[model samples]
Target: MPVPAPTLAAPGESTTPVLAAATDVTKSFGRAKALNGLSLSINAGEAVGLLGPNGAGKSTLISLLCGLRRPDAGSVEMFGRNPLDPKSRLQLGITPQATSVPQTLKLRETVDFVAAHYPEPTPTAELLVRFGLADMADKQCGALSGGQQRRLLVALALVGRPRLVVLDEPTTGLDVDARETLWQQLRDYRSQGGTLLITSHYLEEIQALASRVVVVDRGTVIADGSVDDIRSHVAISKVTLEARCRRRPSTLGRTRSARPLRAPERPPWSPRTPTRRCAGWSATASNSAASKSTPPPSRKPSWHSPAIRKPPRP
Candidate 1:
């Protein structure tokens, strides 16, 4: 399949490729295939969202790019060099799914150690506050909540002043305020000409930040292109509107129909919530009804819903 160059600067400014994977890269564990000939690329100052369902080889590819493990076949490169090269360590930053920030150490101490590796490092104070961990600087990582811990992990990744950052579900446990704050930080990083390869199940987040997306499954690149192009491939958008007036408008820009929603017994499952998916959208809406009837239309859901929906077959 044809893959478009990521949404980015004119091709001339590319000093060297930031990320490139090619050929039939495959990993087999006896009977299971983790990644198969997964060819992909990312450019500097660009954000590429690597999306796939569970066991889709996203994390495995990240590991190969970071040199955490050697690929069983094919090849992966960063900055036009092999990730196994010691030099790649200095140019890459990674925020893993689990909090890698050492819990036994004070947050400041951990950051200082990592920053010491860079000639020019981002100020620790700025990153600490931006990630909501300023007041907790002296506190040990073990004392933090899941959200705070995740924030610390982000801070560590940025302190190294990397050329390319690989983030694996970086916002997994953050509250709304914290999550938005990270997005702003990422925008700033990209604006400064940093390259980012991110894997997120949050499709909305991908839509908001990624200029290009690579959908990988069973170790293969199933689709790769701009977000608009991918959405065009599916070619339909779903529109659902819920308002405080107790009656939804008949149409919300091509909406075929609207369903009257009922209050849910609980919210949806979220790692932070300690409840089920019921605790997520459900509880939020239930609480909103008294202070405010319903959530305002979400821009992500509004545009992305129909785009991912498969069109009716003739």
Candidate 2:
């Protein structure tokens, strides 16, 4: 069935212009539904982050917003027109999750090709230099490293100086320095009034770049708000104490028994602190055999871990 157009802005909402929107959109592939009544909006001059776990419908939603795929139900709009309309996409740019480029074309030629499509494209020289691709302008696309190719893809997205840009995992394979460079460039882009919709597995990346975060799960939005608001709503409270103790102190084992401890390193050593109890807590040596055999609990944070350990409020 044909979907109806979305209203310009919801009642009692901020009047900022909405550059793109998905209204109660749904999509399905065979028996697996990718989206279920999911709705989102991107306002002008805003940097929004889309976050979700694998198979949470984020990619499907992006496809709908970019006109790469039509939704099974509901509507998607870009610049107040149907996204499938070519005219509506002229001011939009996108970097898909998978990266590919013409193997036979030199980096410069590729940039020139994409720029030619826009009436007022950004200068090729400036785009290359800003993305650190100037030195490799003559290199063929096939000869570029994965990181370089990723950077080139991003640079191409901006070649047209788009009003709205959508990036998916923009820094996936980049090292720390290169990641920082891209972050700074994105910040500068937002400062200049360009709107952004970014999806990244890196929570820190989202925190660093987006003023608003949208979290999706079960094919729908579960949370949406500012970074701090999201954090405060879903974050787990963690408290740590620094104490020097020789060997695995009985008190330390008791503390671990009281509550889980996610320590990264072995506890420090000090003979006098074996039974040490800090000011706020009490530590008593237990003679129970189970206490003697208790091991210190430890965990290390990794990129693959959940963005927030605590469960979301109902």
| Each prediction's number of clashing residue pairs | 19, 3
Compute the lDDT of residue 152 as modeled in candidate 1. Answer: 74
Candidate 1 lDDT (Cα, whole model)?
0.63
Q: Which stretches of candidate 2 lie over 4 Å from their true place?
A: 1-12, 236-314
Clashing pairs in 2: 245-269, 245-270, 246-270
Cα lDDT tens digits for candidate 2, 179-202: 767777777777777888899755
CA lDDT of each prediction against the hidden true structure: 0.63, 0.69
Best by lDDT: 2
lDDT of 2: 0.69
- Tens digits of per-residue lDDT, candidate 1, 1-314, equal 12223445433355556554445677776788898878776776678888765677899888888887887888877777788886767878889877765779888888888888887888988878777678988998788888878877777888888878889998876666777677777777777777778897655566656777777767888767766554443222111112311143333322323422222111121122111221122223222212233333432222223343333222
Least lDDT summed over 10 consecutive residues: which range in candidate 1?
Answer: 265-274
Q: After superposition, which runs of candidate 1 have C-alpha atoms over 4 Å from their true positions? A: 1-16, 20-23, 236-314
